[model samples]
Target: MDPERFQKNAMYVETPEVFDAEKNFDDDGRIKRTGTLTTASAHIITAVIGSGVLSLAWAIAQLGWVAGPAVLLAFSFITYFTSTLLADCYRTPDPVHGKRNYTYSDAVESVLGGNKVKLCGLAQYINLVGVTIGYTITASISMVAVKKSDCFHKHGHQAKCSTSNNPYMILFACMQIVLCQIPNFSKLWWLSILAAVMSFAYSTIGLGLSIAKIAEGAPVRTTLTGVQVGVDVSASDKVWRTFQAIGNIAFAYAYSNVLIEIQDTLKSSPPENKVMKKSSLIGILTTTLFYVLCGCLGYAAFGNDAPGNFLTGFGFYEPFWLIDIANICIAVHLVGAYQVFCQPIFGFVEKWSKEKWSNSEFINAEHEVKLPLCGIYSVNFFRLVWRTAYVIVTAVLAMLFPFFNDFLGLIGSVSFWPLTVYFPIEMYIKQSNMKKFSFTWTWLKILIWVCLIVSLIAAAGSIQGLVQDLRKYKPFQAEQ
Candidate 1:
């Protein structure tokens, strides 16, 4: 069997005997049509909005109101543009052939060939794993906030929470182990929808609370440089801070990792690019609206004192009930967010398993698994263990490197150029067969280069920030 032909034919089968979306069934024996415009929009929204939103205020505070939202809107357009390029690459050979690209790696293999597939796979898993670790850190911190709120009521202590994040991280790992066992991407639709709602809910609440506090005469938070608004700061310090802010904004919109996979879930009849374009537009606009509102209001409310996480930071000043509600929303949403991102990682592992062991028990014939009454889900045995182990490993990493903000910036910077900017534009240029030096082609090259340089600088700054923060506070040590 020719490897190139196998790669193409694997996803784009013309014959029903090979693969068909309609023929795919879920655990409940229902045809698994995971991609509807609405559901796909929800999943995209869920993927885009994560713990990153919590830092938008800090990003804005660093750049101030004007440049902050400006950077955000710029990145939104860039992410949407690149993601559409990805969605367009979802199928190959003309509309009649209608072969689908089911994963980002598959799309890369189809357009860039098998050699580049591994590169895509590597960047993708790193991004996904980094995201999973970020979410674990989020869940644990949110849990710690909730616990500390209870402690505040019990003992009236106002300092940092006495509880460590490790226990809650472990608890979150357990939740992911169960959610990750859902067996197929199609099974996670409701979870995605719920996660979307939770994202909106917390964002809205955070914004509303900020507005209320500002109305009550809360002072604007000061800059990290210890200067009040309008006070002079060094140009070099301001420039570096703005650069870091760009990364935080970029990280907030880092959903390119799962764009292809989400499009794969769409119903096949109408053509995916059409639905995906609409979904991307809706998702980005929705998230952008929330981001602008949350970031602006949060900066206004807290000024330079804004916490990296809006809800967590504002909780110190806001009511406990509101704080608990917001954190709980975060905790619940990360559960589903973890599942959304982990599905691709799970698929990759299963693919490797099947290739290495053709008779592996994990690869489902139709991506379906039935639940038994034995209190154990009837997923493939190997899959259950593999996924469980994956979550456990991420949880441990979260324990070891619990620097959520810095680590998220690092992942975003590392992934933003490759997944979001580089591949999409390159594939678009190649797939579209755009002539060299043409207006659009020239601009695409310029965009790619600019993004690469900016991302590299941001990645370096993130690493530097992580090292400095680590020196001041060792991992696994209780926050003082």
Candidate 2:
């Protein structure tokens, strides 16, 4: 998009749509909301079921049949329950007929004010940045998978189809740099819907392949306790992997960071909280079911040796076309997702720069440039330089550490507790005026502490895993 349209279509991915007077304003004097339960649920599922799903099979493999499903269920319930509280916080002082909180940080500022607002902003921006990096890594993996699939199909099953991920990572980063020029690359509302569809496509394809593998006669070994310590892994590695698995699950359900953003899109007539609660339930259930099936079936097929990324990690070698299609879907999804996730970071930094150097022509000036296809768009020197630099940093990081499972787990563990748990719990209690020391309040406190501990342990595990991976591979030299 050119500068004119970029400024016109968006300041962020959730670009405002100008509606006529006939459209209901939802009593907030803002543009009319068209979001219904279906759209809301779609958004939730899209945000929740990202590349994190790629790790679930490995995550489940870390914690066997008994613990894996149980963990997923527990997370589903916790996420849903906390989400209802958060949905209510979308409107301050009242769940209905109250002041609107347009963003998560807005809700935090309105209900639980003070330094927590800064905390919320920090966590959100960091998570968004981390998400973009993760996407960079994930997209590269999928592209590499497409290539590897071809190599395996052309060669033989036993042939070494090994390769590095740096080229693909650079290619993906270059694509993102181009896409980033179009400020509203994702257009959140529509991308959410598209993401949900794409996620379903690839997830179903993966699940189908796993099921097909399991049906092939030979028995695969599985144990109630997952990967054994002595036989499969060292005891220390087991402990760390178990924690890392928890992080992976947390990442899969890490949608709370954007819950208020989705909730803000809902029509207020049905009570946004009511619709949001229902949507959260539906989304989590659907996502969890998909997750359970994928993780369980993938584990059933490969057992102890389940790959961190089943598609790209060389779990299946045949049916090259199907594999290529599934991976292509993932690549497309990540391209959109990366833009959506990174938009906030872009907005934040640009806003800060404009404010800090308000007098600089280089940072403030815009020149109109016409493109044949996208039409005339304004080009800002600062924006071009900053965005390009940002993409470079993320790409360099992805190249330096292409450890998929560990990197994803670290991102999840870092953002899960503060952004997802602590903020929502605090805002809910404060907004509802729930009495201190009450049973519910006490339980919420316990939930906060528990989740915080989990985040810490998960972070440790992920860091350890990254360290171990680094010993095996050099920076920018990551290989399958």
What's model 2's TM-score? 0.88
lDDT of 1: 0.78
Assess the local accuracy of residue 106 in candidate 2 as a C-alpha lDDT between 0 and 100: 81
lDDT of 1 by residue, 104-215 (tens): 8888887888567788788888989889898998888888887777667666756555778898999999888877867658668889999999998888788888888889
Task: Please identify model 1 stretches exceeding 4 Å from their true place.
Answer: 1-32, 153-157, 221-237, 360-378
- C-alpha displacement of 193 in model 1, angstroms? 0.5
lDDT of 2 by residue, 1-480 (tens): 233433432233222345344452345444456788988887788778886676688888899999999999888888888898899998878888789987788888998789989988988987887788888888888888898899889887777777788888888899888878765322355766777888899899999999899889558778898999899999998999999899889888888887887787777778999999999999999999999999899889899899887887778877899989888888878876776667666766777788899788888776767666655566778888899999999999887767654676787888889887898888888887889999999999999999899889989988988888778865655364
For all candidates, the clash counts are 8, 4
Superposition error at 319 for model 1 (Å):
2.0
Report the error of model 1 at residue 403, Å: 1.6
Look at candidate 1 and give me any clashing residue pairs.
Answer: 35-265, 35-266, 220-303, 221-302, 221-303, 221-304, 221-305, 222-304
Off by over 4 Å in 2: 1-34, 181-186, 267-270, 350-385
